[model samples]
Target: MPLRVLSTLDAAKTQYYHFKAIIVAGMGIFTDAYDLFCIPPITRMLGHIYYKSNNSRIQPAAEAAMLVVALLGTVIGQLVFGWLGDHVGRRRVYGFSLMLMIAGSIGCGFSMGTTQARVLASLGFFRFLLGLGIGGDYPLSATIMSEFANKKKRGAFIAAVFSMQGIGILASSIVTMVVCRIFGRKDHSTNDADIAWRLILMLGVVPTALTYYWRMMMPETARYTALVELNVLQAARDMGRVLDVPLSQIAEVDLVPPSPPSYPLFSRKFFFLHGRDLLACSALWFLIDIVFYSSNLCQSHIFDIKDDGSAFDAAFKVAQFQAKVACYFTIPGYFAAVFLIDRVGRLRIQVVGFVLMAGLYFFCTYLYIKDSRGVPFVMYGMAFFFANCGPNTTTFIVPAELFPARFRSTCHGIAGAAGKLGAMIGAAGFFLISKGGDDPNRDEKKTGIEVILITLGGICVAGTAVTMLLTRETMGISLEDNEKEYEGESVQGKCFP
Candidate 1:
């Protein structure tokens, strides 16, 4: 590597070191976690407000109605916003999603009915709109932040942003507990619960507004601007502006056009290439979402009955407690993954994550022994241990690194959509599986998530294998320098970790 280039690259990174990208990215994730985790509380509050005294209706049916509607909306969000993230810039997409969030929260706040059927029917349409915004967030926030961050510390930043999953869960639990403690401490007044829950739903607007601020401050991706023009040099110049360096600073000394485009993702030698790697990324992402969304959304059932005086009320509190605890594990796990990815290398960390998740799944088999309503907390702690620290972090980091500059945003959109597909399947699977069976509450606790975890573990392993074969290393090099290494190439001072 050239001396000035090496030091300048380090300096460019250092200049932005304390600049607050971490906080912005973390908050983005916090909003996501808050949006999704509040479901259990919302359901409990809804039932208490509108249907508890009826005593003849099933809470499970009410819960299922809300979940399926929200999940379907989320799937739609993923596809629509994901394409927008590629076609539109990430900053702009945040505003569009925020509008959806604001509208949904407003709809949910006003919903009221004296009957279960009225309650479910009203909240269903409201929450579906909310899910659309939540779905839009995954690709837009994750993709933009990944593109803007410095490479050496990129893993940590991305993982840190994702760690908001835990924080959001924790924040929602704290809010739910506070609401319960103040109001429900005396009596289960339907009117009180109704007002309290509606207030919480309205609070979602706080994040929607803040998301606008966070996104507005961020620069449109330098790489993205350059690519749309279809000029590598202009792309470098755009990146140079963001990095606050001159165009002369980052461009290759011997610049010619980027390599000729290859048509297929899978080709001769019968292994991974850019296309195959992207395929693997898309497929695996879709698979993981299947497990993650289902488990997260089904918290009320997974934690099972508390057997306290009010089954629905007590179950909601306990489920929040368990989810809060799961957050504790993931927070530290994210930092650990960030520290290790560049040092140990991306593929190794991802494989280790997959292996760890596989081991966690095995333990779930025993945890789900007959008639024993297991503590799903520890099982998820293990999964989070691997996920935040492993594939969850690396899988997101790798796609931006692996694809050629020419296809980066397009490929990211495709892979992100693929991951969304997995999330949709997992969410839908949980919905359908819960929809089936005479006793969904009992059955989901018994067999629902245990089966899904094993399936996610298997898909993660396959995705990891694709990286090892087709992907080249991306550690400690500039994007331009790394692209050189990808085409049977080498660059001075540019070495893979």
Candidate 2:
């Protein structure tokens, strides 16, 4: 019928605006991708200068520190930025996080002697700052994008944005290979060491500024306007414009029920509604971070097939460094999501991903137990597949859809901080296990590498279990209801607490 045709047309046009808004919000996710992925190369560069030996505890510390510090910084960033975003506006916090990323990146590049206490202190401060920015991106981008996207498509859109972390991390690897080639690993002096890191740090500014550029070109979300600006008529007008609906369909009345402009994150009312959801979501994130960081932070180790003393030497050397950089997949993953996301649902993809990842981790665990390289590589490859499919990509998408605008960022921040705490646990977990068991170094009751992989495998399995029990299917639904469910109350329909 003509009516059906018209309805379809209207839906398509509305989607165009949703697409644009999702694109804008997803840019911040791109930064997260870069931060996680890029740090590896910088750490590798540190190996060339400071650690000089890839196997040194210092190298592991630097790599783990890269994630741990960033994770720690994110804890602060999430709490600070999330509160500000909800209080001020997502756009404002988005910009604020970008600035911090730029400053942190540049500061990291300028790090002084790891030998010097002052330099180490400086490194910690700025790396933490960068983490803060990276951390801030999750809630801001996910919430803003989810609000703008159609409910049917929100999960996919959120998944797409979060998937950018893989892309950003991958791109860092690419850049590392190129940059290291240009500035080979061995000038040997502290000055030379600092130079490469500085260059990498400076590059962080480019994305930081570029995010703002795109935001300025876009308008604040109609949803944000509806909720925060208290203008239903204007919100409707904006919505109508984006959806291409007749002005009449978007009546002059406010769409969201009227309520107080401000609310606290921890108010009893909010907690009762959202507490369980937050706990489950946060725990899930913690599990993901444990495996995600443990694997990615030790990317170089994944390629090692032999325990032969000479093989590790070959890998640890500057020559094989290119291979290490190749491990980054965040960049390519992010770009690919730009296309695949609009077409798929987040939960579906995530479930698929986790299933595949469970298999891969299990395989990796087996190989470690068997003392064979084949299964490790196989699992590594499978993880690459899973990165595209689910856990790595889709977990980040959930909070964006489930939380109401009022608590969206807050819930996201809490989840993210929890994940960062997981990252800290993961980062430390690897080094601790890698420490020679029984014998402080060299001799071991078990291979440190196997211990780490098995642990990650166990974590991945735990995620699979929790996700099945705690994860709700978020396929097609009215996005407006997500906000309405809370209808000015935190728990009205939330999965929290």
Per-residue lDDT tens digits of candidate 2, residues 147-214?
66654455566766666555455555555555555555554455654565667556745754765777
Clash pairs detected, candidate 1? 1-492, 1-493, 265-275, 265-276, 285-419, 286-419, 286-422, 290-426
Candidate 1 local lDDT, 97-191, one digit each (tens): 76787788788878766666776677788888987887676666666666666657655566666677777777777776677677767676666
Q: How close is candidate 2 to the true structure, as a TM-score?
A: 0.82
Model 1: lDDT of residue 337: 78
Every candidate's lDDT: 0.61, 0.61
For candidate 2, give the lDDT: 0.61
What is the TM-score (0 to 1) of candidate 1? 0.79
